[model samples]
Target: MAFSELNLSTELVNAIPNSFASETQIQSLAIPAIVTQRDVLALAQTGSGKTLAYGLGIIERVHATGLQQALVLVPTRELAKQVVDALQPIAAELGHSITVICGGEDVEQQVQRLGDCPEIIVATPGRLLDMIRKQLIDTKRIDMLVLDEVDRLLDMGFWPDVQCIINDLVNRQQTLMFSATLPETLQAKVTKFLNNPLKVTANKINSVVEHIEEKLYLVNKGSKTNVLIKQISEQKWPQVLVFIGARDNADALCKKLNKAGIECEALHGNKDQAQREQVLLAFKQGKVKVLIATDVLARGIHVDALPVVINYELPSDPSVYVHRVGRTARAGKAGLALSLVCHGETAHLEAIRQLTKRALELNQLQEFPVTDKPSTGENKRPKRDKQANRRTNQKTRASQFKGKK
Candidate 1:
C-alpha cells in the first residue's frame, strides 16, 4: 500500500524518499494503530522498515509545542543515532525537534540539549535513566514511549533501568514495543508497560530471512582465521560483516584480516562513540571492505545491499545466530551467510539448525581440514582395536629386542 494512504501529514509524506513510496508491511500495519495513539507491540525481522513505521507515527502524533511528547528507547548507542538520523528529516519537515541521549557522548552536552525540550527524544535506557536521575531531563511530560528492539534491551541487561524510566513516566499515553523476537521474560514486562496493546507480526518470530543462503564450514579452532581470509579472497564480496564473540576478538580478527591484505575494521564497545562512527562511516563508504564486530555493539547497524555475513564465532544463543545472519540479504535482496564452526561449536550449530528449521549443510574446506572431532562421554575407539594396538606394540618391542640381541 502507498504511504499516502496512511493519513500522515503532507510535509511528512513528502519527506519520505522515492524508494520508500510503497509502505512495507510493518509500516502499513503499524502506522495506523500508532497514529491513533494506541499501544502497539510489533514483531518484525531486521531491516524491515521498522524505523520508518515508528518514526512517521511519532511525527504524526508529536506537536511542535509539546515538551518531549515521545520517548524512543533503543538497546544501544548506535541504534539511538540511527533512529535519530532516520527521523530527523521528517521531524524537521513537521517542525518538530528530535534529540538523542545515549551513552559515550558528553552527558553535559545532552543536558544542554535537553534544555530545549525536544518534542521527540530517542535514547538508550542507561543514559536516559542517568539524565532522569540527575534531574537533567523531565520524564513527566513524556506522553508516548517507544521500546525499539525490546528483546535486545533486555538482552543487554537494561531491564531494571527501563522499568525505572517507565515508572517515572506516570503520564505515558501510549507505549510501542518493536522487536524481532520476544522471549518469555519480556512478555511479563510487555504486559506491565503496554495497555491493551495491539500485537503485529510482519514475519514469523525467530525465523531467518528467506533470501539468505546459509552455509557452515567446519574447521579446527586454529584454522578459522585462515578459512575466513581464504573465503574473502576467493569470493571478493564488496562488503562483508563478520561477527565475533567478544570485543577483543573483533580487534584481533580485524588486524589479522588487514595483515592478510584485506581492508577491515572493528566495531565494538571499547571504542568511543566518535571512533565507532568513523569506522562505520568508512565501512559504508566502501573504504573498509570488511567490518568485524561483536553482536551487541552492532545492534544499530543497517547497511544496504550487504552481500555477505560471516560468523567467525557463533553466538551461544541460537536466536542471536539468527539475528547475526539476518544482517544480510535485506530488502528482498539475496545474501550469503557463512559460519566458521569448530568441533566445540557443534552444539551451537545444531541449535541454529533447530531454531531456523533449515537443513544447513556443513562444507569442509580441503585446505583447512576438520581435525577436531566432537567429544562424547565414552571413548570412541573400539575395545578390540585398543587391545590389538597394545599387542602390536608388544610385538614391535620384542622384534627390536631380538634384533639388538
Candidate 2:
C-alpha cells in the first residue's frame, strides 16, 4: 500500500518524499490503526522505516492549535533529534510544529521553547519528566503518546520515569509503542500502557537481518585488539562501527586503532552532546573510518549503508548481540557483522546462538590463532591447600586430646 491510500490528508501525502515509493510492512499496518485512533504495539526491525510509520499518523491527526497534542518519548537525545527531523517536513506542510525535550540541552531554553506550545513534542523520558515536575509542560491534555524504542528505554531503566510521565497523561487518547524485541517484562508494561492495542510485527524478533553476513573469530583476550586491527586492515571497510562492552574499552580501543594508523573516534555516555554529534557527523562524512562505542551510546546511532559492525567485546546478554549487529544491514542493505570471541566468552557466544537461533560457526583467523584454553568450569571454586588441611586436622586431634585430659 502507498501513503496515498492510507487515509492521510493530501498535504501529508505530498509531504512524504517521492523516494519512498510504497509503505513498508510496519508503515502499511500501523498507519491505518493509528489514523483510527487505536493503540498499537509495533515490533519491527531496526531499519524498517519505523520513524515514518508513526510520524505520518502523528502529522495526520495533530491540529496546529499549539496545544501539544502529541508526545514522542525516545530513548536518547540523538533519537529525539532524529524523530523530530523525520516529522518536521510533514509537520511543517501541515502547519504543526515539533519541539524536542531531551537531556544535554539547556532546560531553561527548553522552558522558553515550551512557551510556544508546539503541537507535537519529541523528548527523552528524563528531561521530559523534569519539565513535567517543573510544571513547564503539561501532559494531561496530550492526545497521543508514542514510546519509540520501548525496549531500549526499559533496558536503560527508564520504566519509573516512563510510568510517572504516563500517569500524568490521564487524558491520553492513543498510545503507540515500538520496539525491536518484546521481552516478557516489556509485554507486562505494554499491557499496562496500551488499551486493546493492535500488535504489528514486521520481522522475526531477536533474529539477524537476512542481508547481513555474520562471522565469529575466536582469539585470546590478549590478542583481541591485534586481531581487530588486523581484520580492519584486511577488510578495509570504508565505515565500520565497533561495539565495546564498556566506555573505557571504547576509548582504549579507539586510541589503539588510531595509533595503528586508522582514523577512529570514541563515543560513549561520557562525551557531551556536541562532542557526540561531532564524532557521528565526522563518521558520517567519511572523515573518520571507525567509531568505537558502547551499547548505550550506540543505541541512537543511525548511519546509512554502514558496511561493517565489529564486536570488540561481547555483551553479557545474548539479545544485546542482536541489537549491536542490527546497526548494520539496515534498510535492506547488505552488511557484515564480525564478533571477536575469546576463550572465556564461549558461554556468551553460546547464549547468542541460542537467542538468534542460528548455528554460528567459529572461524579462526590463520594469523590470529587461539592459544588460550577454554574454561573448564571446575576452577570457579578456589582449590584447597592439602598441606594446610592436614595441619588443621592434626591440630584438631591435639585439641581434642587436651580436652580429654
lDDT of candidate 2 at residue 17, scale 0 to 100 = 80
Count steric clashes of candidate 1: 0
Q: What is candidate 2's lDDT per residue for 1-405, written digit by digit as tens?
A: 678899887778888887687888889989989988899999887778889999888888874222348999999887898788778987887777889998998989998887887888999999899889988887776978999988888888898999999999988888999877777766896678889999998888877788999999888889999998888998888999999988888898888999999888998889999998788778878888889988864554578889999998888988778778888987788999998998888889888888789998988988877888888877677889999688667775555545443
Q: Can you tell me which runs of candidate 2 are displaced by over 4 Å?
A: 63-68, 380-405
Q: Candidate 1 — which pairs collide? A: none
Model 1: per-residue lDDT, tens digit, 1-405?
A: 788899876777888878775888899999999988789999888778888998889888774224358999998887888899878977886677899998888988998888887888999898899889988888888989999988888878998999899999988989999987776676786767788999999988878888889888889999989899999999989999999998998888888989999988899889888998899888877888899999854454678788999999988888788778878877778999999988888888888878778888888888887778677768677667887577567775555546444
Q: Using TM-score as the measure, which candidate wins?
A: 2
Overall local distance difference test of candidate 1:
0.85
TM-score on alpha carbons, each prediction: 0.90, 0.92
Each candidate structure's count of clashing pairs: 0, 0
Q: Could you report the Cα RMSD, in angstroms, for every candidate shown?
A: 6.9, 4.4
